[model samples]
Each structure stands twice: as structure tokens, then as C-alpha cells.
Target: MKITKLTNNISLKRQLEGGNEEQLKTVRNVLQDVRENGDEALRKYSEMWDGIKLDDFRVSQEEIEEAVANFDEQLKQDLEEAAANIRYYHEAQKRDGYKLPLANGSWLAQRIIPLDAVGLYVPGGSAAYPSSVLMNVIPAQVAGVERIVITSPAGKDGKLPAAVLVAASILGVNEIYKVGGAQAIAALAYGTETIAPVDKITGPGNIYVALAKREVFGEVAIDMIAGPSEIAVLADDSAYADEVAADLLSQAEHDALACAVLITTSEKLANEVAEEVEKQLRELPREAIARKSIENFGHIYIAESMEQAIEAVNSLAPEHLEVVTENAESDAEKIRHAGAIFVGRYSSEPVGDYFAGTNHVLPTNSTARFASGLNVDDFIKRSNVVYYSEQTWQESAPKIARLARMEGLEGHARAVESRGWTKGDK
Candidate 1:
């Protein structure tokens, strides 16, 4: 990390990588083929991309049981406990339809309806993310979604990650598939012989998966187009340089494009943290990736005052923010933009990523300026309900018709006016 004086003209926004023309064409073809050919297209693509022949796309109950049976006892207990925490937290977010009172027995209500089905796409390759499984499945389950599906590309050995399988089993997720890439997205959006279509899709994947999600968005709802992981620390001299460096590196190791930043009022703390980051980076497991990320996106900005530092943080609107000042909670109140805020030294960013009740699927890049983390609200829909008593309608109909006519919507005006002033049969 390099130290930079916080300048008035600098911008922290990073653009999302859009798919190339060839990738877009490939995604379109794959989606269309899957929509038309169903399971056959899925098999062909799986064999080509994942380097494995697909016999059965769905994971069997026997395999689920075996994964659960062979999982580590301590890890099993941890996952169950994590699942309980996630379920308990999300359960409180549940909502019911409620009506707004209106005079003359006329009212409107907002209906909260859960999607019938949802698909969670957990990335698989060299690494495994059982945390993704737990994070995605628990909220949809709490939202009361009836059918939840899991899809990930199989390894060359023709199996998804065992840890992922174990986590899904812990959550009692019934449907698991050995497919990935755009084809898995298509299968989830449009249905195959074995897999059924879902109303929404959640979770992240590679560029191809992201493009596929963007392509199928109107057909089936998608959470958001996630970007690289990011963490911004607002610290002062009270913070430990080593602790701050470790927290910055936590997100930096996620991807070569990940971003880690520090904004502080103390020049001494900024320089100390910069040196500490380099020292810690030398010993990290993913040093290559973290170094590249820190080299490109990491920075330490010295602000003239804490107010200026807080201003820089809100301008950045980072995905994960750590407040390690004299009064962490008090400073956090002044912040307006962040996917998740970690208060105090003990409240590390990883706490929310895995064990904490909060969801880890956060908006990355600078999208935290407007986007939010995944939650129960993502798995449900809201409908507007309207009712009008005869008297209310009669009193309001002419005004409604006159307003519709002002907009030149003759059909709307006529529709309301056709309801007649009185209910009487001669």
C-alpha cells in the first residue's frame, strides 16, 4: 500500500467489467440452446467446459447422506450452529400483508409473497465456499421459498466440492446439480428434464456466469451483478497497524481486482499501516493475488482531520468498512455508505462473512452507494392490493376519471366511469 494525501479531485469509483462481444454471443447461444434442448444442451456444455461427461445432472440423496456422514464432527456442529444463527436472524425479517386505513371502508394493502423457487450458484473450482452455501440457502429458506436449488460445475472427477455438499446437506437443501457456467444459469432460469425453473437466482460466479445472469434477468429475477471484494478502514492512532493491515489483506486476497484502503487523520498511523501491510503481505498464503490487488487498488490516504477522513469514506462507499477510531460506534453513525460496518477492533470483517448473522453477499466495487446485501427481501415479492367501498368509489370516480383524461388515457377514464353511480337493478 502507498500513502497518498487525500485530494479533492480523486474518485474512488471503479467500473464493473462488462463481458466482451464473444462472451456475450456465447452466453446468448448457451441460453437459447438450453432453453430449446434442455438437458441435452446442459450435458454438451458441461462436457466441454467442465471436462466431465454428465450422466446425471442432479446429485442423489445417497451422495448427500454420504457427504453429511463423512463430514468432520466439529465442523458439522459449527455449520449447524451457523445455520441456526442465519435462520434465526433472517426469520425476524419475515413480513406479513398489511392494509393502510382509509375512510368509508376503502383501503390498500401491501402483500409480501415469497417466491416459489430459487437457485443459488456457488462458485467451484480450485477453492470451495461452504460459506456461500450457508449464506444463500438460509435466507431463502427463512423467506419460506418452497423449492431451492443448488448448482455448481463438477470437478474433473465429476463431483462438486465435498464441503459445499456438506453445507447444503446441513441446511437440508434437496436439489443439487453438477453443472456450472452459463448453462447452469439457463437451467435454473428455464427448466431442464431434471431441474425445474426458479423464480429468482442468487449467488456469484465468474464473468460468464455474471453475463448469463444479466441475460436472464427479465425472465427470472437476479440479486445483483456483484463486483470484486472491497474493504475500507477508517482508523486513527488508537488502532493497531498490524490489526488494520490484516483486515485490509483479508479482502485483498479475495481477487486480483480486490480493493483495500485506509483513510486516517494521523500521518504516523498511515505510514505505519503502509509498512505493516507490506510486511504482512510477505507472509500471506495468497501473496501473489493480494500483492497484485494491493499494488493496483490499495492506498493509505492522510486526511487533515477526522471529518475529512469520514468524508472520504462516504465518497468511496466501500463494500466492507471497518471503524477503528477512538469511538468506533460514534464514528459509524456519521457514515452513510457501506455494505456492512465493523465497529471497534474486535468486530472484524470476517465475523460477518461466516459466523455472524449478517449475509456476506454484499455489493462490491462502489455499488454500496445504492445497492444492499442479500437478505430475505431478495427472495420475496410485494403486491399492491386495493379495495374501495361503493360510496368511496362513487365519490372518487369522477375525480379519478378527470385525472386520467388529463393524461389522455381515455380507456382508463372510461373504465372507472363505467362502474355507475348507484347499484340498482330495474
Candidate 2:
């Protein structure tokens, strides 16, 4: 990692930009093929990509039980504990439909309805995340979604990762499928003979998965077009260089395009963190990937003051922001745009990623500027409830008709007038 002086914000902005048009084109073709051919296309693509041919894509109850039996006792306990924490946290987020009484004797409310079915896409192959299973499923369960299905690629052996299955089973998610990539997303969005269509799809994958989610957005609701994982550490002299380096490396190791940034007021701390990042990179198992990420997108900026540092952080709108300063909590308040904010050095990014009960599926790149992380809200829809008393309608009809007429919606005006309330009646 190199320490650079903070200058043009645009330069930093350009580093976070991602998504390849070439990959999107491929993803589009895959989605189209699956849309047209459904199950046959899914099987062909599965064989082409995963080197496996499947007569049936759905994971059986026997398979789920085998996965549970095969998993180590300690790992199962950890998953259960993590699931408990996640479920408990999200249960608090569970909300009910609300009604409000208006002064005009009208009633307005919102019905918070959970989706009937939800599809969770978990990455397989080199990137199998059981933690993602827990993070994605728990919220949907809490939101009262009746059917929660998971789609992941199978290996050459045609078996899902035992850990992934174990986590899903722990959450009582029985509908598991052996499909992945853009094809799997298309299956969830459009449905096939084998896999039923879902109301929404949520989780993370590579560029293909992200582009697929973007393509299938309207046909089936999707959580977000997640980009590469990223983390921004806002540190001062009070922050530990080694810990900062470790946190940065954690995200960097995720992908060659993953971003790890540090914006600090102290130039000394910046240089120390850069050196510490390099030292830590030497020992990481995924050093090649982390080094490339650090070389390509990672940066350490020296800000003139704490205000300037916070300005840089908000401008970047990173997915994960860590405030490691003298008053970490106070400094965290200044952050306006970030997917998740971690305060203090001990509250590292991984704590939130796995066991802290916070959803790890966060808005990535700069989308945190407007979007939010996956939660129960993502799995539910809100329908506005409106009721008006005859008196209220009578009193408001002329005004409503006049507004409707202004918009050239005479039919709307007439509809409002049809209830025996006319223009100038009030």
C-alpha cells in the first residue's frame, strides 16, 4: 500500500468505479437463454460452468440431513450461535402495519406485507460463504416469509458445501437448489419446471451475478446490485497500525477489485498504516489477490484535518467505514454515506460480517450514497391504506377535482365527482 496526499476527490472516486460491459453482455445472454429455455438451459449452463450435469437441481431432505451430520460439532455450534444472534437482532427490526387517524375524519395506513417467497443466491466454487446463508435467510424468516429458497452452484461432485447446507438447515430453510451464476438468477426471477419463481432475490455473487440481478430487477425484486467488497478506515494516531492493516487486508483478500482505503489527518499514521499493510500482506494466504487489490484500488490519503477526513469519507460513500479516532463515536456521527459504520478499533469489520448480528450484505462501491444494506424491509412490500369518510370526501372533492383538472385528468375529476360530490359542492 502507498500513502498519497489527499488532493483531488475525483481521483479517489474513479478508483471505486466497477462493472464490465463485456461481462454484462454475457450475463444478458445467459438470462435470455434461461428465460426462453428454463430448466434445459439451466442444466446446460450448469454443466458448462460447474462441470456437473444434474437430473434434479433441488437438494433433497436426505442431502440436508447428510450435510448436518457431516458438519463438525464446533462449526455447527458456532453457526447456531451466530444464527441466534442474527435472528434476535432482526426480530427487533420486524415491524407491523401502522394506521394514522387524520383530523379530517379520514384514515391512512400502510400494510407491511412480507413476500410470499424469496430466493437467496449464495456463491459457490472458490467462494462458498455459510455466513452469507445465515445473514440472508434470518431476516426473511423474521419478516415472516413463508418460503425461503437458496440457489448455489454444485461442485464436480454435485454436492453443495456442507457448511452452507448446515447453516440453511439451522435456519429451517429447506428449499435448496443446485444452480448458480446468471442462470440461477434467471431461474429465480422467471421460474422453471424444477425451480419455482420467487417474489424477490437477495444475496451476493461475482460480476455475472450482480449484472444478472440488474437485468432481472423488475421481473423479480432484488436486494441490490452489489459490487466488489470494500472498506474505508478513518484513522488517527490513536488507531493501531497493525489492526488497521488487518482490517483493510480482510476486504482486499475478497477480490482483486475489492477496495481498502484509509483517510487520516496524521501523515505519520498514514505512513505507518501503509507500512503495516505491506507487512501484513506478506503473511496473508490470499496475498496475490490482496496485493493486486491494494496496488490497483487501495489507498491511504493524508488529510490536513479531521473535518477534511470526514469530508473525504462522505464523498467516497464507502461500503464499510471505520472510525478509529480519539472520539470514535463522535467522529462516526459525521459520516453521512456508508453502508455500515464501525466505531472504535475493537469493533472491527469482521465482527459485523459474521457474528455481530448485523447483515453483511451491504451496498457496495458508492451505492451507499443512497441505498442501504439488506434487511427485513428488503423482503417485504408496503401498500398504502387510505379511507375517507363521506364528510371528508365531500369537503375535499372540489379541491381534488380542481387539481385533477389542472393535470388534464378529467376522468379522474369525474371519478372523484361520481360519489355525489361535485365541483363547488363544498
Candidate 3:
């Protein structure tokens, strides 16, 4: 980890890995094949990519029960409790429709409706992403989405990970599919014979899955095109260097491109954290991967004051921000641009990632400036509803026509005028 002075122009925005031409071409080819050939394409690609071959993609009840039987009881209890916590947290995000009355019995309204179906793309094999399953599925369930589906790559032996199956079973999400990559995205967007199309898709995936989501975005709604994970710790001298270093390494181990940074007022803390990060990197099981990330993107910035530290953190807009200061809550309140904030020493980043009930799906690559983590809102649509009375239309037709014609949309102007008020009649 490198230590440097914080500057006004300091930024940690990653250049996201948008796929190259070859990868984009492959993504497009896969999306098109799945769109046209349906289940045949899914089967062909599942075998080629995941080495999975099944007559049907859906996971059966028997399979789910077997997975549940095989999984340890303690893990099942933990997942169920985690699901309950997640459900409780997201319940607050549910929205209700509203209508406002206007003059002449006219009214404008908004309808909050859940999507008919949504697909969650859990990366790796099934067992690898049970946490993702919980994170993505619970919110949609909270929003009352009717059909929830899980898509993951099967293991070489053509089986989904048992933990994943158990997690889905805990949530009662039975529509699991043994497919992955761009093809899974395509199958979600355009229905295959075995898989039904969904209105929205969410979850993290590799470059190919990200590309496929990008390509199919217009055909169906999608969560943000996420980049690698990242974390930024805004700590003061009161924070322990070792604890800060450990938190930074948690995100660094996620991907080689992942970023970890510390902006602090104390230069002493900066130097200590820099050394501590190197010491901790050696102990990480994913040492090589974390080493690459820490070497390339990790840093500790020395800020002249807390104000400067907060400013630098805002500029970065990290996916995760941990505040460890004398006034942790006060400092966190001042932060305006973080996907999630961990306050004080106890609220570590992983708490929200798994058990703390906050959604782990977050915007990365500085998109925290505008985007948000997945929530009930992502699975629901707010449709604008309007009911115009005859009297209201008669009173507003001429003005509406004039505004439409100002934009040179003659057809639009005429359409507005055709509601019984001619140019001379009004």
C-alpha cells in the first residue's frame, strides 16, 4: 500500500472493465443464439461453458430437499435468520400508490406495481453465491415480485451448489436454473423453452455476464452494470491501524481490480496502516489476488484535517465507506456519496454484506455518486396514471397544442387538438 498526501483533485474512480471488441462480439452472439434457439442454445452453452448437461434447467423439489438434507443445520438456521433480517430491513422500502385530485374531476396518480418476474444472476457455482441469492431474492420478495428465479453455473458434475439450493429453499425461491454467463442473461431477457422471460434482472457476474446484461438492457430492466468491489475507510488517529488494514483487505480480496483506500488526518496512522496492510496481505488465503489489488490500487492518504479527509472521500464516492473517528456517526452524517457507510469500529463492511440486513449489491466505479444498492424499488415500477375529464381537456387543449407545435411535432399538436376543440372553437 502506498501513502500519499490528500489533494483537491485526488480521486479513486476505477476505469471499469468494459469488455473488449472480441468479448462484446461473443456476448452479442450468445444473446442472439439464446433469443432464437431458446433451450437448445442454453443446453449447448451450459455444456460448453459450465460442463452441465440437463434435460431441463429448472431445479426440482427433490433436488432442493436433497440439498437441504445434505447442508448442516447451523448454516440453514443462519441463512433463515439472515433472510428474516434482510426482509425486515427492506420492508421499509415498499411503496404504495397515490392519487392527487385536480380541478374539474381530473386527477394524476402513480401506481406502485411489482414486476411480474425477475431473474437473479448468482455468479460461480451454486454454493459459491448463496449470500448473493439472499441479497437479491429477499428484496424482490419484499416488493412482492411474483416470480423469482436464480441462475448460476453448475459444477463440473452438473449439480448446483448445495448451499445455494438451501438458501433458495429458505426463501422458498424454487425456480432455480443451471445456466450462466451471457446465455443466462439472454434466457432471462428472452424466454427459452424451459426458462421464462423476466421483467428485470439483478446480481453480479463476470465480464461476459456484465456485457450480456448491458446488451439486453433495453429489452428488459437490469440492475446497474456493476464493476469490481471497493472500500474506502475514513478514519482518524483514534482508529487502530490493524483494524483499518483488515477492513481494507476484506474488499481487496474480492478482485484483482478491487480498490481499498484510507484517508485520515493523522500521518502517523497513514504510515502505520500502510505497513499493516502489507503484513495482513501475507496471511490472506487469496494472497496473490489481494497482493495484486493492494499493490495496484490500495493507498493511504494523509489529510491535513477531518474536513479535507471528508472531501477526499466524497470525491472518491467509494462503494463502501467506513468511518472510524471520535464522532463516527457525526462524520458519517457529513458523507453524501457512499454506497454504504459503516459507522464506528463494530459496524464492519462484511456485516452489511451478509448478516446486517443491508443489501450488498452496490454501485461501484464511482457510480455511488448517483446510483444505489439493490432494494425493493428496483423490482417495482411506478407508473404514472392520468385521468383527464372532459372539462379539463377542454380548458387545457389549446395550451397543450401550442406547446406541442412549438417543438415542431405537428402530429402531436394535431392529436392534442383532435379532442373536440378546433383552432377556432377554443
Candidate 4:
């Protein structure tokens, strides 16, 4: 990993913008074709890209039962444990809006309503991520979403991964579909003959799936179009070099484009981490991808002071931030941006990813500054409610009338006027 001072703006814009005009146009065309041609277009794209033909896109109960039976008892127990932890954490996030009565007898309240349906997209190609299934599905279930669906690509044998199916079964997501890519997104966005459209979509995917979510934003609500996973560790001389190296490699294994950064005040620590990364890289199964990611996008910045380290971390706003300094808790509190923060040596990134009862589907590519990680709140909506008694209307009549007329909205003034309240009433 190379260390460079932060001094580039144009390059930052290029990375943040993600897709160009051409890619947007292509994605838009695919979404349109799916909307118009329906299942016919889905079959065509599945053959062209996935190199498979399917008789039915939705996974059946028999398939799910078989997949669940195939899993060993230990694997099944692990999935259940992860799901239980996720559920407990997210259930605490459930909010019930309250109603209040004013002195003038007016009522104001907010009602929390769960969405009707939600869809989750699980990537299938190189490897399957049952862990991702637990992360995305459990939150929606805790939010009390009515209908939940899972979509992933099928293999040449026309079967979804056993682990993916098992996870879906464990989460009570019966509506599993074999379709993937832009087609699965289209099916979720706009209802097909077989698959019912959902109110919102969540989960991660490759470039095409990301582009599809971007294209169908208004037609159906979507979680952010996620970039490659990222992790930024803010450490100092007090931190162990090998521990820092291991956490960075955890994210690099995601893909060739994934980013892992180390920002610290110790030049010595930086050098040690770089050497430790190389030593650990040899033992990883995804060594080639991790090597390329670390080579191209990874870095170790040497800040002159702890304040400068915090400033550097803010500039990056990485998806995951690990603070391991002399005062790690204090440093973590000073951080303004990051999807998730891990403090101290024991709080590794995987702890939150698998256990520790926190959502792992977080914002990436510097989106932490504006967006947030997926939670139970994402599946619920808040509606503001208001009611004014005749006495309350009378008290505020003059001000309401004046403001409504000032805005040239006579209907707004008359709506209150119809209540038979005079401007002079007191």
C-alpha cells in the first residue's frame, strides 16, 4: 500500500460519479424493455448474460425444503444465531410515534406505518453470501414488512445456492425468485405475471444491478446504489500492525475494486502494516483479487497529528471506520462520518459484519456523509397528523388568513373561513 497526502479533487469527482451517460442510457433501456416485454425480455437477458434458460423464475417450496434439508446442523444453527442477534438489535430501532394535545385543543401526532412489501437482491456468480441474506432480510422482518421476497441468479442446473435458499427459509422469505441482474430489479420494480412488485428494494449487487436500481428509483423505492465495499482504519503507534493489516484485507477480499485504507500518525506503523499485508496476502484464497485491490486503491496515509488523521478520515468517509489510537473512544466520537465505527483492537470489522448485533449493509464510496446504513426505520414511514378544534381555529384565524392571502392561496384561507371563525375572534 502506498501513502499519499490528500491533494486531488478531479480524481475524487471521477470516482464519486460512478456510471457515465452511456451506462445510464443502457440501464434505462434495459429497464424499459423489461417493463414493456415482461418475461420474454427476462428470458432473453438471462440467456445472453447468465448463459441459462429457465422454465419458471420463482423458486418453489419443494426447492426451498430441499435446500434447508441439505444444510448441516451446525450451519443451520449458525444462521439461526445470526438471525436472532440481528432481529434483537433492529427491534430496538422500532419506533411508535406519539400524539399530543395542545392547550387550544388541537391534536398533533405521527404514525409509524410499515411498508406493504420489500424485495432483497442477493448476488450469485463467483460466490454466494448467506451472511448478506441475514443482514438485509432480518431488518425488514423486524420493521413488520408484510411481504418479503428474495432474488438471485440460478446456476446452469437452474437451482439457487443451497446456503442462499437456506437463509431465505430461515428468515421466513418464501417468495424466492431465480431471476437476477437488471431483470430481477425490473420484476421487483414493476410487477410481472409471476412476480409481484414490491414497495421497496434493498441489498447489494454487481454493476448491472446497481445501475438497475438507479434507473428505477421513482417507479419503486430502492436503497442506495452501493459501490464496492470499503474499510478505513485510523490507527497510531499504539495499535498492532498485524491487526490493522488483517482488517484491511477483510474488505479487499470483496472485489478487485474494493478499497482498504490506513491513516495514522506513525510512519513506523504504516510501514509495518504494509509488510504485514504482503505476508498475510499469500495465505488468502482470494489473494489475486485482494492483491490487485490493495495495489490499485489501497493506501496508508501518514498524518502529522491525530487531528490531521481525523481530517483525513472525514475526507474519505469510508463505509467502515476502525479507530485504534491511544484514546480510541475519544477519536471515534470526533468522527463525523462513516457507515459504521469500530473502536479498540478487539472491535474488528467482521464482528459487526457477522455478530455484535449491528446492520452490516452500509453505505459505501463516501456516501456515509449523506446516507446511512440500512435499519428497521428504512422499512417504515412516518405520517404527520393534525387536527384543530373550532376554538383553536378561532384563536389562530387572523394569522392563518393573513399568511394564506399573502401567499395568494384563497382556497387555503377559505378552508379555514368555512369553519365560521372571524379574524377578530379572541
Candidate 5:
């Protein structure tokens, strides 16, 4: 990892804005073709990209059951454990409807209603991520969404991963489609003969999927315009260099574009961590991707003090933040912006990703400053309600009329006047 000094007045817009307009245009073309051609377009893309020729685009319940039975028992147990932890965390996020009564013969309240349907897109090209299935679907289930649909591509054998199917079934998401990439996003955003349109879509995919979500925003709701995964570690002299190096590499393994930055008050620890990263990089299965990510985006910034390190962290607004200092919890408390904060050496990235009982689907590309991770609230809507009796309306009419007239809304004033008010002298 390269050590770089921090500068003032840096343009974050240059850092956060997405890359490769040509790739975005390619995604746009795929979305348009799918919108016009429907299932046939999905089949062609699946064959072209994944090398799988599918007779049916949707997975049947029987297939799911067989998958669940045939899957490795130990992996199945691990998934169930992860699912239980996820459900336990998100179940607390489920909100109940509430009502408030006004002193004046009126009632005001909000109703929390779940979306009628939701779509979850899980990437399938590079690896099978059953953890994603649990992370995305369990929240919707806890939120009481009625219909949940899942989309993923088939392998060259034209079979969905057993772990993916088992995870979906465990989460009670029965609707599974084999379409992937931008076409899957289109299928979820706009319904076809086979796939039903959903009110909202959630999940992470390639740049094409991100661009497609940006294009279909008004037509259907999307979770967020997520970019590559990023993690920032705030370390001090007490931090272990090898552990810091491993955590950085964990995020770097995501993709070549992922960022793993360290903001440290101790230059000695920073130099040691760089050496540790070089030592550990030789053993990783995805060393090529991790090395590229570390080479391009990873950096160590030496800070004069802990406060300056924190200032650097807030400016970055990283998706995942790990604080390892003399007092890690105290350092974590000082943080104001981060999608998720993991404190101490024991709290690593994969713990949150797999079994730490927190949502791992977090905001990326500095969006932690404004946005948040996936939660039960993302699957539900709250509608405001107001009820007023005739007496309350009569009491407030003059004020309403005056405000409306002051704003040059004569029609609104007349509407109040027509409610049986006598003409008044001003």
C-alpha cells in the first residue's frame, strides 16, 4: 500500500462520480433491447454472457426443493444460522402503524404499509453468493412484503446454484427467475409475460445493473445507485499491522475498483501494515484482483493526531469503517458518518458480511454521508392520514383562507368561503 499525505479542499465529486460512460451506454442498449423483446431477449443474453441455454426462465418450486435436499448439509446449516441472525436483527426494524389525536376534534397518523412486491437481483457470474440472498430477502419478509422475486443467471450447466435456491427458499421467496444482468433489472422494473413487475427492486450487480437502475428510476423504485465496495480503517499505535492488512485485503477482494484506505496517527504502524499487506498478498486466491485494487485505490494517510484521522474518515464517508485504537469503542463513538462501524480487532469485515448480525448491504462511493444500508424500512412505505370534524374545520377556516389569499390562491379562499361563511369587513 502506498502512503499519501492528505490535502485540504479536495474535490470529492471527482472521487465519487461513477466511471466509464461507454459501459453505461452498453447497459442502456441492453435495457432497451430487453424492454422490447422480453423473455426472448433474456435467453439470448444468458447464452451470450453466461454460456447457458435455458428452456425455462423461471425456477419451479419442485426444483428449489430438490436443490435444498441435494445441497451440502454443513453449508445448509451455516446458511440457516446466518439467516436466523439476519432475521433476528431485521425483525426489530419492522415498524407498526401509529395514530395521534389532535386536541381539536381531529386525528393525525401515519400508516406503515409494505410494498406489494419486490425484486432481488443476485450476481452469478464470478461466484455464488447465498449470503446476498439472505441479506436482501429477509428484510422484505420482515417488512411484510407480499410478493418477492429473485433473479440470477444459470451456470453453464443451466442450473441455479444449490446454495442460492436453498437460501431463497429458507427466506420464503418463491418467485425465482433465471435472468441476469441488465435484462434481469428490466424484467423486474417492467413486467413481461412471465415475470411480474415489482414496486421496487433491491440488490447489487455489475455496472450495467447500476446504470439500468438509474434509467428505470421513475418507473420503479431502486435501493441505491451502489458502486464498488469500500472500507476505511482508523488505526492508532495500538493497532496490529497484520490484522489491519488482512482487513484491507478483505475489501480489496471484492473487485479491482474497490477501495481499502487506512487513516492512522502512527506512521510506524502504517509502514508495518504496508509490509504486512505485501507479505499476505501472496496467499490470497483472488490476489490479482486484490493487488489491482490495492495498487490503484488503497492508500495509507498519516495523521498528526486521532482527531485528524477521524476528520479524514468523515471526509471519505466509507461504506465500512473499522476503528482499532487504544480505546476502539471511544474512537467508534466519535465517528459521525459511516454505513457500519466495526470496533476492535475482533470485529472484521467478514463478520459483518456473514455472521455479525448486521446488514452488510451498505451505501458505497461516499454515499454514507447521506444514505444508509438496506433495512426493513426500505421495503415499506408510510402514508400520512388526517381526519378533521366540521367544528375543527370551521374554527380553522378563516386562518386557512387568509393564508391562501396571502399566497395569491383565490380559488383556495373561495373554496373555504363557499363552506358557508358570511362576508366579513376587513
Candidate 6:
């Protein structure tokens, strides 16, 4: 890991920018092909990207049952527990429609409607993320989204992972498809013979999937354009160096572009964490990827004080923030921007990633400054409901016309005038 003294803020801000034009162009072509060719494009792109040809894109009920039947019982139990926790947390986030009464016998309200259908894209092949299945699907279920479909790349054997299938099945999501990448996104957006178009698409994938989401955003609602995973640990002298190192490496293993940073007041603790990260990286199964991530984007910034450390954390606005200091909770309160905060040494990031009931699909690449993590709100839409009685319209007509005419919109003003009042009468 590289160690640097805290200096320029621009250097930190520049890393947050995600995506490139070349990647966007490739994704655009894939989306266009899928939009024009439909199912044929899905098959062709599946063979090209996933190295397999498929006769059917949707996973059959029998396939889902078989996967669940063959899955490990212990793991299934664990997933069920995680799913329950996830559901419990997100259920509290479910919102109800609200109505407000007006003075002139009129009413203003908002109707919170669940999306008609939703598409969940889970990365497949070598990576199997049943946890991601729980994190993404359970919230939509809580939001009352009825038609939840999942699209994942098939393995060389032309099958989705048993864990992913079982998780989906457990969540009562039966619409699983054997497709992935930009083509899968395009198919979900535009629909094919086998796959129906969805109102929204949510989940994380590679660069192609990210860019595809960017292109199809207007056509269909999307969760967010997620970037590589990142973590920033705010530690002081009281922090455990070994645990801090392990937490940093946890996100670093996600991708080569993933960033793991540490901001601390104690230089001695920083050096200890740097050494521990080096030592621990050797034992990780994904050491090569973690090592590259640590070498390239990993940083240890030495702050003169805790206030400076907190300032650096806010500037970075990382996807995950771990506060390991005296009174970790108080220090965490000082942090204004972070997708999720794990307080103290015992509260590791993976707890939220797996079973702590919090959503792991967080805002990455410094989007924590404004955007938020996935939740029930992502699967629902809010529409304003307005009602105006004849008396209400008559009372407000003159004011409405004056305001509309002030903007030189004669048609708008006349429309308001037609309600009850004329321009000369006002």
C-alpha cells in the first residue's frame, strides 16, 4: 500500500469520476443491437461474452427447484437468516402514501406505488453472490414490487449458481433468466420474446453493465450507476492495526480499481496498519487482485488531528467508512458523508455486507455525497395527487393567470383564465 501525507483535495476529488467514452460506446452498441434484434441479440451476445449459447433465456421452475434441492442445507439456513434480517430492516423503510387537506376544499396528496416490474442483474460465472441476491431482492419484496425478475450470466455449463438460484427462490422470485452483461441489461430494458421489459433495473456489474445502465436509464428507471467498491477507514491511536488492515483488504479484493484508504492521526498506527496490510495480503485467496488494488489506489493519509481525519473522510465520501477510534460512535457522528459507517473494531464491514441487515449495495466512487444505498424506495414510485374544487379554482384563478402571464406564457394564462376569471376581470 502507498503512504502519503494529506495535501491537495483535488487529488481526492478526481478519483470519484467514473466511466469512460470507449466503454460507453461499446455498451451503446450492445444496447442498440439488443433494441433492434431482440432475442437474437441476447443469444449472440451471450455466446460472445459468456462463451455459451442458450436456447432459452428464462430459467424454468424445474431448474430453480433442482438448484434449491441440491443446495447445502447449512448455507440455505444461513441465507434464510440473512434474508429475514434484510427484510426486517427494509420493512421499516417502507413508506405509506400521504394526503394533505387544503383550505379551499382541495387536497394534495402523494400516491406511493410499487413499480409494476423490476429487473435484478446479478453477476455470474466464477463469482457467486447469494448475499447480493438477498440484499437486492428482499427490498423490492418489502416495497410490494410484485414482478421481480433476475438476469445472470450462465456458466460454461449453461447454468446459474445454485446459491443465487436458491436465494432467489427463497425470496419468492421465480423469474430468473440465463443472460448477463450489456445484452442482459438491453433485453431487460427493451424486452424480448422470453424476457419482459421491467420498470426498473437494479444491481452491480462490470464496466459494460454500468455503461449499459447509463444508456437505458431514461427508457427504464435504474437504481444508480455504481462504480468499483471502495472503503475509507478513519482510525486513531486506539484502533487495532490488524483489524484495520483486514477491513481495508476486504474491499480491495473486490476489484483492481477498488480503493482502500486509511486516515489516522497517529503515524505510528498508520505504519503498523501498512505493514499488517502487506502481511495479510499474502494469505488472501484473491491476493493478486487485492495486491494490485492496494498498490494502485490504496492510500494511508496521515492527518494531524481527528478533525482533519474527519475532513478527509467527508471529502472522499467513500462507499464504506469504518471508524476505529476512541468513542467510535461519536467520531462516526462527525462524518457527514459515507454510504455506510461501521463503528469500532468489532463492527466490521462484512457484517453489513452479509448479515447485519444493512444493504451492501452502496453508493460508490464518492456518490455518497448525494446518492444513497439501495432500499425499498428504489422499487417504488411517488406521484403527486392534486384535487381542486370549483371554489378553489375560482379563488386561485386570477393569481395563477398573473403568474403564468408574467412568464410570457399566454396559453398557460388563458388556460387558467378559462377556469373562471378573464384577464380584464382580474
Give TM per candidate. Answer: 0.97, 0.95, 0.95, 0.94, 0.94, 0.95
Clash list (residue pairs), candidate 6:
none
Model 5, span 1-426: residue lDDT tens:
989665555422215447488988888888888888888888889889988888789999899999998989998889899999999999888879899987676998999999999999998875899999999998999999989999998888787888899999887777899988889999998887789899999999987888888899999999998888899999999999999999999999999988999999898999999999999999999999999999988899888888878877888889999999988998889898899999998999899999867999999888899999999999999999989777788888899999999999999998976765564655
Among these predictions, the greatest TM-score belongs to 1
Candidate 2 per-residue C-alpha lDDT over 1-426 given as tens digits, one digit per residue, 9 for 90 to 100: 778788755456644455688888899999989889999999999999999999999999999999899889998999899999999889999889999998678999999999999999999986569999999999999998999999999988999999999998898888999999999999999999899999999999877898899989999898988878899999999988889999999999999889999999888888888889989999999999999999999999998889988989998899999999999999999899999999997999999999989888998878888999889888888999999998888889999999999999999998988987344566
- In the range 1-426, model 1's lDDT, one tens digit per residue, is 788899877777765467899999999999999999999999999888889998899998888888888889998898888888888888898989899989999999999998999999999899989999999998898888999999999899988887899999888886999989999999999999989999999999998999999999999999999888999999999999999999999999999888999999889999889999999999999999999999998989998888888989999999999999998999999999999999999999999998878899998877888999999999989999999998899899999999999999999999998877554665
Alpha-carbon local distance difference test for all models: 0.91, 0.90, 0.91, 0.88, 0.88, 0.90
Worst 10 residues of 6 by lDDT: 8-17
lDDT tens digits, residue span 1-426, model 6: 777788646356435446688888888899999889999999998888889989988898999999989989999999999999999999999889999999878999999999999999999868899988899899998999889999999999999999999998888888899999999999999998888899999999988888899889899999998888899999999988999999999999999888999998989989999999999999999999999899989999998778878988999999999999997999999998999999988999999999989999999877899999999999988999999987898888889989998999999988877655434544
- Encode model 3's per-residue lDDT on 1-118: one tens digit a residue: 8888888876667665678999999999999999899999999998888876778788889999999998999988999999999999999988799999999999999999999999
Residue lDDT tens for model 4, 1-426: 887654423122115347778877877888888888888888888888888998788899999999998788898998899889989999899888999989777899999999999999999996888988999888898888989989999887888999999988888888888899888999899978888899999999878789999878898899888888899999999999999999999999988888999998998999999999999999999999999889978888887789888877887888999999989999999999899999999999999998788999998888898989999989999999999887887788878988999999999988877766334565
- Stretches off by above 4 angstroms in model 2 are 8-10, 16-21, 103-105, 421-426
Error of 2 at 364 (Å): 1.5
Please give me the total number of clashing residue pairs in predicted model 3.
1
Ordered from best to worst lDDT, the candidate numbers read 1, 3, 2, 6, 5, 4
- Ranking of all predicted structures according to TM-score, beginning with the best and ending with the worst: 1, 6, 3, 2, 5, 4
The C-alpha stretches of model 3 lying farther than 4 A from their native spots are 125-127, 408-426
lDDT of 5: 0.88
State model 2's lDDT. Answer: 0.90
lDDT of 4 at 220: 87
